[model samples]
Target: MMLNDIAMIAIVGAMTGVTTVLFGFGGGFVVVPFVYQLFLRQPAIANNALHIAVATSSAVMIVNAGWATFQHQRRGNVTADILFPLTLFIGLGAVMGSLLAGQLNEGTIRLLFILYMLVTIVDCLVSRRFLKGCEARPLSMSTTTVGGVAMGAVAALLGVGGSVMTVPLLRRHGFSMKHCISHANPLSLPVALCATITYTFDGWGKIPDSGFIGYISLTTLVTLVVAGGIGITISQRYFPKIPDWWHARLYVLLLIAVLIAMLW
Candidate 1:
């Protein structure tokens, strides 16, 4: 890769880190499209560029989500009882999603990703309940098992951390934006870790490339993780200071911006 490529990676990595700390994204929303666009022109990996993008996004999320979860826990943002059980279901779903993804065409998967993102954005905007915060209610067994698993499956398939869905789900269920994002971090961790493992092992010896292990581009993964870590360390101070209304508005705006960028 050229120096300019590295520079672009670092730039996007820092932005990913900022989003992780502030929106609980774990770099998926940013990483998937950026990496796909960057690698699509390379003849060797062109056909599998979307898979590589998703796999690499998952690898990046393991670090971003894990680190952000730790920070959120420190602030008493994570609810342990709900988190543990939900994580189990999400993990199971992630493995399922990862295995199924290899059977899909790259264009089909990309289409799914974009469509899901559009739906999510529209859901948040039209709901009208997202900005009004309420006390968080207990998770029903069905929501924990069925919803968690579905979220994991979809997030794994799309290379997202599931924050886009979780945040809105939690918000609709009466969570404040601050705590919703906090909970989103821990919830995303399992999805990332489980998906990464499946992607790495599933694609090994199959991709026909030197720089990739499975669908992951190790060089890109390492660079993004390191730069994202630095970004988290630097930008975390801005997280707690935002007001709830502004926070919720910004979240929607960010999703809209990402949607526009992806479509363009």
Candidate 2:
């Protein structure tokens, strides 16, 4: 509500936008840590800082991921055949995950978040499949069923969305870095929607502030969406110019940076 708060959040929003478009994060990775820290200072919500952060991250993703998916669709980067089947299961998992997240204590959620990031960063770094993927192939039913549900569940629980899982999964199927990340947008959309709705009702009247609607910060959500929109528009023009190899490398580096931020 203060000028400084608005400015700082807007900055975070801009960063969220860039990540959403470039890495299919949809503000999940950027918003969670920051919002967690922000809410920690409020006595009323201090104990639930991470909860509010995770829920708000989900809310922000609804717009960021959805819009990014639309843009990706125009570019012919989305694989509908692969996307449709996975999407349904992801939604189911997201509902389950959001419920689970609400039951977790703050410390437990933070630890799990840190551990998940470490594993993901290590996997992306050591895995040869991430850089030079194979030919594009249809995902098997079993793969989509298990992977989609798992991805949505974990993503909703951690508030990181499916980019961390979906992109890597798609990469092995021979998608270029751009296409792999592009596909993540659509996959993330369902997780955001389902998680936000679940948390909204589950967290009703829990946070004492008027600014929050359930566990989500209504003001921050709008700011991030607006700022993220500008960022997405700017990034789209330059996205195709990046080399695939660099894209893969940068993704890993971004993961590392996020890991450090979480720890910090």
Give TM-scores for every candidate, taking all chains together and pairing residue i with residue i: 0.95, 0.96
Give the range of the ten consecutive residues with the poorest summed lDDT in model 2.
Answer: 233-242
Q: Give the TM-score of candidate 2.
A: 0.96
Where does candidate 1 clash, by residue pair? none
lDDT of each: 0.86, 0.87
Residue-level lDDT for 126 in candidate 2 = 76
The numbered model that scores best in lDDT is 2
In candidate 2, what are the lDDT values of residues 4-91, reduced to their tens digit?
7877888999898899888888888899998898878878889989989999899999898998888888878877787888999998
The lDDT, on a scale of 0 to 1, for candidate 2 is 0.87
lDDT of 1: 0.86
For residue 109, model 2's alpha carbon misses the true position, in angstroms, by: 0.7
